[model samples]
Each structure stands twice: as C-alpha cells, then as structure tokens.
Target chain A: MAETTWRPASARGAGGATATTRAWRVWSSAAIVTAVVLAVLVVPPVVNLDEQAVHLADKLLPPSWEHPFGTDDVGRDLLVRCVYGLRVSLLVGIVAAVVATVVGTAVGALAAACGGWVDRIVMRLVDVFASVPHLLLGIFIVAMFRPGVWPVVISVGLTHWLSTARIVRAEVLSLRSRPYVDAAISGGASRWRVTVRHLLPGVLPQAGLAAVLMVPHAIWHESALSFLGLGLPTHQASLGTLVQGARSSLLAGDWWPTLFPGLFIIVPTLAIAGLAGAWRERINPRRRSELML
Target chain B: MLELRSVTAGYDRRDPVVRDVHLTVAPGEAVGLLGPSGCGKSTLARVAALLHRPDRGQVVIDGEVARGWRHRAPRAQRTAFGVVFQQPRLSADPRLTLTQLIAEPLRATGRAAEVPGRVADLARTVGLGDDLLARRPHEVSDGQLQRACLARALVLDPRWLICDEMTAMLDASTTAALVAAVEGYRARTGAGLLAVGHDKVLLERWCDRTVHWDELSGDAAADRTT
Candidate 1:
C-alpha cells in the first residue's frame, strides 16, 4: 500500500450515539415479530380448529374459566374458533403480502431498470390499479371466482401490490439517479450486476417495508370478503367470517363471539403493522416519514 | 487518451448543459477544468468518463469512437478510466462499506478474489486505515469518504482518473492529502487526470493546464426562437 496523508474519519463513532435506541428497537421488533410468527405457526395446532364442534349444550355461553372466550351460536368454543380464525386470517395476510411483494418488486424493478416504454406501461398500469378501490376489486374478483383461500389470497394480494410496486418504483427511480449507480455503470458493471448489487439493496428495504404494511391491509381485505359472503368457505373459519357470523348473535346480546374475535383481527393487525414500522425504522432511519405505504 | 469531440450532453432536455465541447487529456498529463457552478463542467467530466451519453457529438477513447446515447462500451473497454463524482456521499453506495466500494471496480472486472488484498493496499494508499473500511458513508466524514472515493477510483489503475469537484467539500489539509494520494497513484501508473473545481490557485497548483466550460445554459447565441 502506498503511504499518503490519510486520517481517521471522525472521532465520534457513527453508531455510537444511537446504539441504545437501535438495540432496543431491534430487540423489540424481533421479539414482536417472533411472537407473531410463532403465534401464526403454533396457534392452530394447539387450538381446536373444528368450528363444527357443535355443543348446543353450551350454546351462547359468555366468558368463563371453562370456556375462555365463551361459545358461539353454533355451540362451538369461541376461544378455539377465534384462534383458528386468526390463524386463517394471518395466513391469508402473510401469503398475500408475499405474493404482492414478489409481483410488486418484479414490476417495479423491471420498470425502473428498463425506463423506457416498459417503465411507462408499468407505471401507467400502477396508476390505473391505484385509482380503483382494492376492496371493491377483491370483492368483484371473489364474486367471479369460487370463494376459497387462494381466491381470497389472489384477490387481496393482486390488488394490494399496487402500493409495493409504487414504492419499489419510487425507490428505484431515486437510486437510479444516485452517482454510485452511474459510477458502477461507468466502471463497466453489467446491468444484472448493477441491479443485483446496487439497485436490489436499495429497493429491498422500501419494498419489504411496504409489504409488511400491506399485511394488515390484506388481513382486513380477507375479513371484508368473508363478511360479504365471498371469502372463506363455511367449513373453514376466518376472523372476518367469525365476526360476520356473530352479527346475529350480537343483536341477540351474545356479544362474546363477535367482540372477542374482533379483537383477534384488530390486535394482530396493529401488532404486525407496529412491528413492521419499527423494523422499517431500524433499516432506514432517514426516511422514517417518507416510506410509501 | 480521453477525448470529448464536439460533445453536447444534458438530461433529456433539448437545450444541452454543455454544447459543442472539446476536451482532451493525454496519458501522464493532468488537466484542471475550472468553471462557475452549474456551468456544465461536471457534465463534460461525465462525458469524458463515458458515464453520460452526449446528446450530440462523440466521445473518442483511445481512437475508438464510443458513440450513441444508449450504446455503452463493454467491461474491458470502459475500465480504462475511473471517475469520482463531486459528492462523495452520492458517489459511493451508503449500504456498502469502504472496502466494498473500493473493491467494486475490481469485482466488476472479474477480479473478485483480489478485492481484500487490493482494498488493504488502496486503503493505505489513500491514507485511510483498514479499520475505516467497514464503516458506512454517513459514518465517515466527507474527507474520509472522499478518500475512499479516490481509493475506489485508483483501485482499477485506469489510464485516466477524473475527479469532478471531489475536494470542494474537504478541508485544506485533507484536500492536500487526497491530492497527494492521487498524485502518488498517478506517479505509479502515469494516468491522466481531469479535475473540475472553482478554485483557481488550487487548479494551477495541481494541473499542468486548465480549461473553461462554455456557458450553454442560457443567453447563448445557440438559443433560437420561442
């Protein structure tokens, strides 16, 4: 190595000041995400998923030590049913978010990288998709197709990808103008190399953050479809279906079914969204407010 | 040799930032480009580096006419010169470490195995210790980041090195140190240098000759009717 007048950058370490806050955020985010993932993975196995476990002998029972969340009109244990419902709702939300991220990242990355007619077409397509209400589209799609898990997943996933696509597009658009990108190109880095090395790292954070935010939206979408009678089948339990099923019971003052299951949907959505926001902050603290939903 | 022959370049605008520009830097020569802010000296540097495609005219490198806006030179051909942009923060990928940034050109050219050794070598050359290689752009001062940029540029040992106002943000001593690093690299490889800045005395001190960019942004005779 040639000797020159090199110097230490700054006396103050970069991560020194924010270390504690970052550690706290990371630990909490990890713990929350782990709990959610564990719940999503573990709840169904422990709980009785069979909503048809009709116990007319225990019909409309309120919360008690024996029946924790109580029983619904079907006489099935509300606790078990709510757990199963959340499991299904969370599953749909996760799969749908994954699907959306994959599709969105592909569209966004391709559009931004290509940046000609492809960009115009993809962006216009996003604009067109963004103009319509996602729920209405999901409902219409569910109405067209047989109401099933995949149909709901597809409907919600496809509709919700517009945001991720937009996020990836915006990220790529900015990253493309970055001088490092230009430097890479000038240094003869191939298109794939540039995309994989430079562009991919830049886009992943925005895309992943958007996808995480989309989970709750997806969960809500599934619930809406089920409420509208175009979501999960009767044999299965989703939080939306459980809440909708409780509508009649609610009128009759059998509030345990609706109230408890509603919390099931709301809590997970809030938890996941909060964790996602925290994780996003952990990744890119600069654009804490600028992250596109 | 790096040559811009009657080049006109801009960012998707009809009116070019630089118009009908001619610039050349021969091997072992150091030329400074002095101009006012936004006068398109950086644009010309970009053209000279083949990083920006000119709207019109040609960028001829080593007697090869690398023309057309979209068509780019292949890996081996384009690796003849390395360019450091004005803003070190913008020019270096923040996610990557100084090690990764310095090794980028080598990795691009299928010399991935040599990255670690070359990175250590360049870190010392730029007067930056290997300890700083792991830190990010925001973690380091602009001077240090600019030194990393210089190291990255020199890692490839290209026939030409172009610094586009690279020292504008650095302190005097740091700037001198960076210039010394570049000079040391130049002495070793005998590469040409093109530096753009607003500093006259500095340019005079560092460059064998200096040139000015034509004012093509507004109020030029090239502008026609409404």
Candidate 2:
C-alpha cells in the first residue's frame, strides 16, 4: 500500500479548470446543437419549381423562371415538391440512423458485458449480417415488408446496425478491463450497474460520433433505393423520388427539376458530413491535443 | 482476526504467485507484510481482502472459513476490511471527483446521507481541501489522488486496512506524511492493518511487526509466533 499525497487546493483547482476547458474545447456542444437546429430549420422551406408557372400547361417544359425549376409532365410544382422532398429525405435518414444506433448499442453492450456463449452467439450473428452488402440487404427487406416509411426506416436501420454494434462492442470490451470496473465490482455493483454507469458513459462520446456519421450513409442508401423505384411510396415525395421522376426528362433539356432537387440534397449532405468531421475532431483526444498545441 | 491457512492462489492455475503460506493478523494489531517485487505480497493481500479465492486451504476470519461468509456477511462485516492497491488510479475511478471517490464506500453501503460531513472530515485529515474535492481524478496530481483513495478506504472505518504497495508511487515527503497519518489513525482507533510493501525500512517504521513470506514458507513445520 502507498501513502496518499496531498496536493494544494489552488494547484488542484487549476488542474481541474484546465481539464474542463480542454473538454469544452474538444466537444463544442453548442456548435453541434446549432448545426442540428440549422439543419432542422433551413431545409424544409426551399422549393425547386417556383420560377416556372405557365409551364404547368407546357407539361414538361425546359428550365425557365415561369416555372423556375421547369415543370414535370404532370404539371406539378417541382420546386415545392423538392422542398418537401428534402424534409422527407432528412427525416428518414435521421430516424433510421437513430434507431440503428440505439438498438445496435444496446445489443452490443449486452453481448460484450455478458461474454462467453452469449458473446460468441451475438458476434456470429453480427458477422452473418455484416457479410451481406447493406444496400442489398435493405432492398430485400424493403421488398419483403412492402415499401413504406417505417419499412424503409427499419430496413436501413437493421442493415446498418452491424457497424454501430461493432464500434460499441469494441468500446465496451476495452472499458471492462479498466480497474474502475473491477472496483465497481468489488463494491458489490451488479453487472447491469457497471454496464450502465461505467461502460456506457465511457463509450457514449464515440457512439454519438458514429451515430452522426451514419446519418448521411443511411440517407444516401435510401435515396439510391428510392431512385431505383424501390423506396418511398408512390405519392410521397423524397429527393430520390424527385430524381426518379426527373431522370426521363433530362434528355429533353429539362434539367431544372432534377438539378434543383439534387442541389438541395447535396448541400445538406455535405453540411452534415462537415459537422460529423468537426464532431470527430472535437471528441477524439488525439486530435484535440494536436489542436491544443 | 484474519488468517490464511496454507492458501495458494494466482492469476494462472499452474504458477501460484502466493505459494502455500500461513499468516494471521490479530484484532487491533498492525502487521506489515514485507517481500521483494515478485514475492506475491499483493496476491496475499487480495486473498485477505476476499478479492480472490485461494486454490488451496482456507481464508479464515475470526476462526470461521471466510468462503462461507462470502455474500452472507452483513454490510458492516463486508466493510470491516478494506484493501488499497499499489496504483491509486486502480483504486479510484478516473471519472469521479475527489469527494465522490472518497465517499464511495459510504455510498456503497447505503450511507450516502452521511457523505457530506464525512467527506469534509476525511479531506481535512488527508490534507485535501474543498477545491481538490471538486476535481476529477485525472485533474488532480497522483499524490493527491492517492490521498483521496486513502480517505475512501477509511470512510467506512474498517477494522482491517490492507494496503498493497500503497506508498510506492509517492515522493518521500508525501510518503512520510502518509505514514504519519496512518500512525495517527492507528493510535486513535486501534484498528488492525496489513501493510504490504517491498520496502523493509517503511515496514519497520510503520508496522508493529513484520512478516515475510519467505520466512513463513522456509519453516513450515515450526510453530512460528510474531
């Protein structure tokens, strides 16, 4: 046993203050929240076909302000539809990613903590699921369930959960080895208590970053499936549906309908990707330390 | 009193770190376990603290086999013995503040309501003030964290404090101060202590009697008394 050394209050306080400041710099909690809020607010009101009005009569008109994004053969507002489509696409992406992260993290934590046969079984199942291409798996699931929001959400969520599960499992495995975990055990903490209080908190920052990164991935997959006419029901307007409808007219010199919606999708996608990059930089200690110097 | 009757235990099955060893610490006695680095001092400490089960013989406390009392012991009985590790980092959670770390044993036994006063008292005794109590483990110096760990070990006022190389990481002055603090506590409460260390000088100065594992193993047939 070693003798306990006392540190002066001021020195200890300074150390704690420095650590907290560093943590705040690394996280930028406010910036993340603001990005999320901006995404929520800005993407919904942008309409693509507002400039072209009389093109409603022209059926499929070329790009012109009268129906700024031109007109579909059905005389619909491509701009309005694109704006609404952005909302739907973002909604599906976020919902699917969140569901996947939650379910995946829970299953992964359980498998890692309980280990032995349970761990082996869970990992084998994860491997089986991971071996299949997620897009193909999602398409198969959507086909089986019939196309709808929930089905697409579930399909993408279930298919993409392998990555999240793997990340969480690795984190939990490492956390279990720390001496504080042993200390918690010696203090008569139940397995569940240790997992929830110690293990989960340690892994949460990483999981959160992973969850954010998965959003764009899920969105892209969903869009691709929808563009192929496999996602989002017939009446619903997603960016993929808009793109699917506009593909036939691209050759007729009517690029406004597709171009406008594509820009809308790309802009948000890039923004989200940027935010994810920033978040990773903040949460990762190695990166944060580099920035500090 | 805690006793080990020819206990054998180790991380692996084949190579027992603590060989067949018999030792005892009577009630209210401060005994130091002295040995070299590879002599299994910590393993023996773990056995006494019930953190590990010996592969052979019995860990007997108060004339009864301790295995039977494992989960059946009362809360106070469980807290009657506290073990501190060589690394203070290992003893305390890095995420916890000094106050939380020191108050952990109290909270563990459902005595959280008594934490505020007890924490303040322990901090004062260990020379950790209000400011240090608010900081997390990594934020504080190693010496300060070790002091917090010591305070945590004593919060429940355990009868047997098993410290395994507890002062090995500290500077000389800090170690000396801690030694004096332990001595003061022992004088005041008359609690039994099992301080394990490789430093013979520390053992001689801090403990009433020194017990070496080699000596215990060398003369197994002799009825040894310390």
Candidate 3:
C-alpha cells in the first residue's frame, strides 16, 4: 500500500501570479508551440511533392541555401520528406496514444470499480494480451486488416491498452481500500458516485503520467510496423515508410535517404520522452521537497 | 436510544473480535465503553454505526430492531446515527473542502437542500471559521480536521453519536476542547452518545455511566446488573 498523502488545499499555487514562475510557464508554452509547429505545419509542406527527378536531383544535397538538408536519390528534398514524415509520425503517435489511454482508463475503471466477475474477466483478458509481444501483436492485427493509417492506429492502440489498463487497475485497487472509500459507502453514496467522484480523480494523476510515457512507445511501435510494410501505405509517407524506402538506398552508396528519415523517427521520440520526464518531475515535486526537508 | 442485543461480529469465523456483546444507550444518556487495546471496542462501535453487520444479533435503534425497520427507516434510520472515527485524518476525503465534507451526511441522509445552512451552522458550532470551509483536510490542523469530522457528524442531527477513540490523536488541551464541545452539543440536542475510549478518566468525566466491557458478558442479566 503505497499511500500518497494528499497535498494541502491551500498549496495549489495561483495561476501565473509570480514573475519567475510566469517566465518558466511562458517558456514551456513556447517550447510546446515550437514542437507542434515543427511536427505539423513546417514538415508537411516540405514533404508533399512527387517526382523521380526531384528525388534524384536533390539527392545528397548538403544543408545549403538551395537544398537545406541536401537531396535524396530521386531529388526529393530530404528536409521536406523529413518534415512531412515527422508530421505523419507525430499524428500517428498522438492519435494512437489518446485511443489507448481512453480505452484503457474506461475499461480499467469499470473493471476495478465493479469488482467480482467483471474484474476477474477483464484482468484475465488483459493478462492474456500482455503475454504477447506488442510488435508481433501489432503486425498480426495490421496484416489481418488491410494496411492503412486508421487500421494500424487501431491495431497498435488496442495492443498497447493492456499495459495502461494494468497500471490503472493497480491504482484503483489501492484507492479502493482507503478509508474515504469506506466513508463514502457509509455516508450512503451510490457506488457509481464514489467510483466517479472519488476513485477516478485519485487515479487520474497517475494515468496522466502513464499516458505521457506511453506516447513514445506507441510511436516506436507504429514506426516498426510501418518499417515492416504493415503500417500506413506507401503514399502516406510516415517516418517508418520513409525508413523502409531508404533501407535499400542505405545499402547502396546513398545514405541521405536513411539518415534524414531515421532522424525524423528518433528526434520526435526523444522530444516526447523528454516532455514525459518533465511532466513526471512536475507532478511529483513532493519527492524533491522530501529530499530537501 | 440504541441497543445491541447479543451482537457477534468479526472479520472471520475463527476469532470473533466482538463475541456476543450486548450494550444499550438510553435517550439523552452518554455511555462510555472502557476497554484496553485489542478489546474489540472499535468493532463494537462499527456494529453500532451499522457500518458492519453482526454475525448474529440485532442492532436496535429507538426500540426497533434495525432489520425490522429497514423498510420504514430508509435514510431516516441512517440519519439517526453518526460515527466519529478513531483517526479523523482517515475519516474524510482529503480532496473535499471542509464545507463539502461537513455537508456530506446531510446529502447522504436525503436532506441535500438543507446542507448549506446546516453546514454553516455546524461549522460555527464546532468553532471553525468561514475561511476554513474552503480548505481541504490536509490544509487544516489535526484538531481542525477532527472538529470538521464532528461538524459532519452533527449535520444529520443524529440521535446517537458513536465516538470511537475520537480524541485519541489530540493533545490534552485539544481533547479537553473537544470534550467541552461534545458536552455543549449534548446539552443543545439531547442526543445519546456512545463514547469509546481507553482513557478511563476522560470517559468517566464525559459519560453518565461507564461500562467496563470485560465485566459484562453477553447475558442480558449481566448487562442489567452492570
């Protein structure tokens, strides 16, 4: 029973009142905007083009006024492809992460709150799914359905939900034993009211951390599936598809195709991971205070 | 008035925490249950609060067995009793404001509309100020939290107040203040109270009669003699 003592109500700091805190707040907001813009707006325009000559002629063009990231084998702008690939990769990651979080949280809350046979059945199903490797599961589901964006999204999203469900269930189980829960029952609160108003909020702060951590994992899984040609189709130009397309070129003399797209895969994943770490740090500021005291 | 008729309750079959216990609290009377640690005082208090169902026996409130009045009582029966837990910190939801916590019993007792005014009055009676109502449990001192718990218990205007080591965590002065507050409330409401504590002096001072549970067996005759 790892009990987290509730923070004092008066400790909730007022929003944007202090100068130093406001500065950091502004900086974080700008960082978020920059990350979104790089992934969404800037990248798509650069990557949306079609020409074999454009791909070849732009190939190996170094960062210059003319070709910022140089060119690939078919002269398509490496920078453009990288940007567009980033957009697609980020979109898949975010959408799949959201789907996994919502599905996992709802089902987990239901199972835990409604214990008995519902809990047993849901947890047993989760255990079965957990035993399978996420990559293999994702690939199998993508292959079963025709390879497409939403299909891959659903497949990967559904496959990763077990972990989230398990985490949330663990949280809910511990919360159920707390005295406030008993108090709520004794106070004659309906089961649903207790679950929704009391248990759910206690579980959410942890669920948020889980969601952040899951995004990178989801992105990587989607990329791997796409790299294996079981993800979004060729026309979609995801980072995974880009990596797959560039694999042969890498074996040949050309490295630009693989290198740029690989960066596309790695950079955003690292950024998301960084954001998750920062969020965890922010939420558990008590850990630092405990050390200080 | 509240009565426990040969109440037998425990977590399991092997060892009954409370073994065929019988007790009674007359109207407007304060009965202190005195026992050492691990003497099942808390278990008995829970049974009296209806938080725990007895293995065998009846919990009678106002001369009617609880099971018999189940249909007729509804929210009224629940509202007729309030429990102050051993640890006030664990008694109320940490997320709820003092106002919400105090008003909870009122809402639970199906008197939601009366909560706002009732809560304000209870807060004042319990010596909590207006500023404290907006504060969460952790924001307040332990004494304040316990007072809030007391305020919560008072909202339903329960005929019986079951205090299970309610002052155990408080310092001497704070405990004395709580006792005084209880005395004031009793004078105002004429409600029966079952005060459970290990502190013999405090129990004796607060209650009209003290019952050392070990001296009384499950026999009604034994209870009458005591």
Candidate 4:
C-alpha cells in the first residue's frame, strides 16, 4: 500500500463556517436581491395603483425611463403590473410548496415507519400519482374549482407532492438501517421517540431540498394554469395572467410585456435550483469536509 | 444472573448461525466467550444481549424469562443490561457530541436530570477527557470514540453488561484501558458481564471463566459452571 498521512482535526476547517467559492453563489445572491426588491414593491402602500390606470394616449410605448417595461395597449405600466404579477405568483408558489412538503413528508415518513404492506401500498400510490404528467393533472384539478388563488395553489400542491414523497420515503428507508437508529431503540426509545429523535432529523435535509426545488415547479404550474384561463381572476396581477394578456401585443411587434414576465419566471427558477444545490453539499456529512473553512 | 438457555438464532431462521447455546454469568462475574472470526460468537453475544430474539429456548434474566425482544421488551428488562458493540462509529449518531452520545440511554429512559453528572462521572471512569466529550465521532480518533462508547455503555449502571468484540477495532492500549474501565465498573456494581472476543489471552486475564463456542453444545458443558 502507498504511504498514508493523517491530519489533526484542528487542521480541517469548521463544518459550516467555511466560505464557498462556487459560481452559483453569485446567481443565488442576485435571485435573493431580486426577490427582496419584488417583495418591497408589493407592499400595499409602496405599490402605486395609478401606474396600472389606463392612459390610452401613451399606449404601446417601447421601453423608456418613464416606463422601463413600456406601456401596454391599455397604457398600464408593464413594470408595475409585472412586479405585482410576480408577487402573486411567488405567494401562490410558496404556499403550494409548503402544503406539498408537509403532505409528502408525512406520507413518506408514515409509509417508511409502518413498513411491510403499508410501505408497498404507499409506494404504489406514489407510482400512480407520478405516472400522470403534473401539468395535465394540475390543469384537470384546477378546472374543477373557480379560477382563484386557493384553487390554483391546491391544484399545484396536490400534483407536486408525489416527487417529494418518493424522495422522503427513500431517505427514511436508508436511515432506518443506520446503526445509530438501532442504538437508539436498544437504549429503550419507543417507536415514536426514535422516529422523532432520529428518523425525522435524518430526513429533514432531503425534505428541505425537495421543498426548495418544488417552488419553481409550483410557480410554473400556477403560471400554466393562469395562462389557460383556469387560475386566478383575469384582473389579478399574476405572471401567468400578465403573460396571457400580453400574447396579442407579443405578436403585434411589441414584446416588452411578454419578454419581461418570462425573464422574471425563468431567472428565479434557475437561482433557486442553484441555491438548493449549494445547500445539499453543505448539509451532506460525507462531503461537508470538502468545503473551505 | 444472565443466562441464555438452548438458544438458537441467526439473521435467517432456516439457517441459524449459532444453535443450542447455553451460557450463564452470575453477578460480579465476567464470562468471556472465545471463538475465531466467523465462528458465530458475535451472533451468540447478540442473543445473550437480548438485542436479537432466539429461534428457540429462552433468555432468563435475574431468574425471569424475557418474553420480548428489542423495544418490545419490558422497560425493566430492556434497561437491565447495557451493551457496547465492536464499531463505535457505526453505533453512535454522527449528529451528536460525545456528551449527547453517552447520555443517550439516560435521556431515553427519562432520567434526563441525571444525564450531566452521570455522563461526566462515566467519562472520567472510561478515561475520556473533558475536551473530547465536546467532539463528534468523526472529530475524534478510534480510541477516543471507543472510550466514549464505553462511557455510554456503563452510564446506566445496569445489572448486566455485554461487550461484543468491543475493542477489536481499537489498538492494544485502548483495549487495555477499556477492559480496565469495565473491570472497575464490575467491581463497584457487582454487575454480571459477558465479554465476547477472539483474543484468548486477553479474555483469560479479564474474565472469571472463559468458554469456547464449541463447548456450548450439550448439557455436559453446563456442568463445568463455576
């Protein structure tokens, strides 16, 4: 065997205190800054409704200092409307993601803990849900309810939980075989105690990753539903509705309205995915030492 | 007394690893189980520890037959013995510090208030330094982590102790220190001990009576009891 060397623990950096030089940090920070700006713009008093008022004389103006995203055919400031639209989309996405994560984690943890036939049955149910394409199922569900925020949120949340459920179930199954879990049981811990103390904490990172990644998907799902005129009222400023209303202008040689909203959706999705990747590396015990302190 | 009567157990029921094993350890006595690697000694040790249920026969603890295994065992039966395994790293939770690891049993058994003092006392007994108690398993050497595992095993002060190749992965000096700690605990509490190891000379020195795996076959072996 080749000669081996050992280093003192002190020589290695602290686990999470280390600086990360990954390229994704730049994009993640930019995304966070954009989200914060959009949040500020959504504050009730900060948002000026006059920008959304009809000024037909100034209609179809291209991008400029006065109206950065230009005026729509009805003369509403495209920037203000897009910001409001993004705010609605973000709110719906987050609420839906939370709902999905909670349901998925509970179902997965239950299936794994119960094991035997219960596990097989829950996994089969997951397979059934996963077999159907998310967009089609989401649209089908949304079409049943009145076009509104909660209906869209419920539809997106219900359709997206299958992936999270699968991830958490796999994670919990792996964690079940860990020796520490056996040690906990041998130490006189009840099933519930072991589940709460060991199994749940072990699965949190993977579950959090699932939730973060689900946000972008949920946003797009809501957008698709809205664009199909099956989500949020037509007057509500959502990225989907804005994009849907801008379709005529987009084909009429005016593209700012459609272009800006499209960028708003794509940029944040990429940023969040990037941030989740960084988070996965940070929390992973095996690869944690590889990070610089 | 801790006794395994006609026990037959293995991972697979149809092909049991260790069969019809009979062993007993009286209070204050250390019984070393000596066998070569893959000779089913560890499997026997697990059966003796009540961590694994026997395919037949019974595990009689303090004259009472244990009716359950693992977490299903009665609280008194479950808490009656403390066990230490071969690999400390695999046995301990990575997220916990040495203090939390050692205090796990105390916390689990609802003796929460006694954790700090008991863990500190056991750490000293096992020769684990205060500085080492704050570190996780990955942050410490094999010897340091094994010392913590020993401390964890002895923290509950049970009537019985089971060491299943506990020092096999450790160096000689660590092995000596851990054996001394177990002996010291036994002397104080008069606890019955079942030390499972392949090292014949070490077992002869540490235990009151050492038994070979093959000797545990028939009724004749039970007659050689001390």
Pick by DockQ: 1 or 4, better one: 4
RMSD to the true structure for each prediction, in A, is: 8.7, 9.1, 7.9, 6.4
lDDT (tens digit, per residue) of candidate 3 on A1-293: 99987655434433313435534544674586477566577544565454223545445665577766666656677666677767777778878888898889988998998888999999999889999988888888888888788987888789877877887888898898676665565565666777887888988887877776677777788889988888988666778888888787778767778877787676656655655654655776443211100
Give each model's whole-structure lDDT.
0.81, 0.76, 0.77, 0.82
Worst 10 residues of 1 chain B by lDDT: B216-225
> Candidate 2 — which residues are off by over 4 angstroms?
A1-40, A43-55, A65-69, A77-79, A144-146, A251-267, A285-293, B5-22, B38-40, B52-58, B63-78, B187-190, B213-226
Error of 4 at A167 (Å): 2.2
Q: Give the best candidate by lDDT.
A: 4
> Higher TM-score: candidate 2 or 4?
4
Predicted chain A of candidate 2: TM-score: 0.79
> Model 2: per-residue lDDT, tens digit, A1-293?
99997655433222244545544533564555465455455644442233224344677766678656766767777666666677678889989989899988988999999888999999999999999988889889899877878888898888887888888999899888675664555454556767887889888887787778888787787788898889997468888888888887888777777888788677666656655655675576344222110
Candidate 3 wrongly placed segments (more than 4 Å): A1-56, A59-65, A144-146, A278-293, B5-16, B53-79, B107-112, B187-190, B216-226
Q: What TM-scores do the predictions have?
A: 0.84, 0.79, 0.81, 0.84
List iRMS for all predictions. Answer: 1.8, 3.2, 3.6, 1.5
What is the lDDT, from 0 to 100, of the residue B166 in candidate 1?
84
DockQ of each: 0.45, 0.20, 0.25, 0.48
In the predicted model 4, the residue pairs found to clash are A18-A293, A85-A237
Error of 3 at A159 (Å): 1.8
Report the poorest 10 consecutive residues by lDDT, candidate 2 chain A.
A284-293
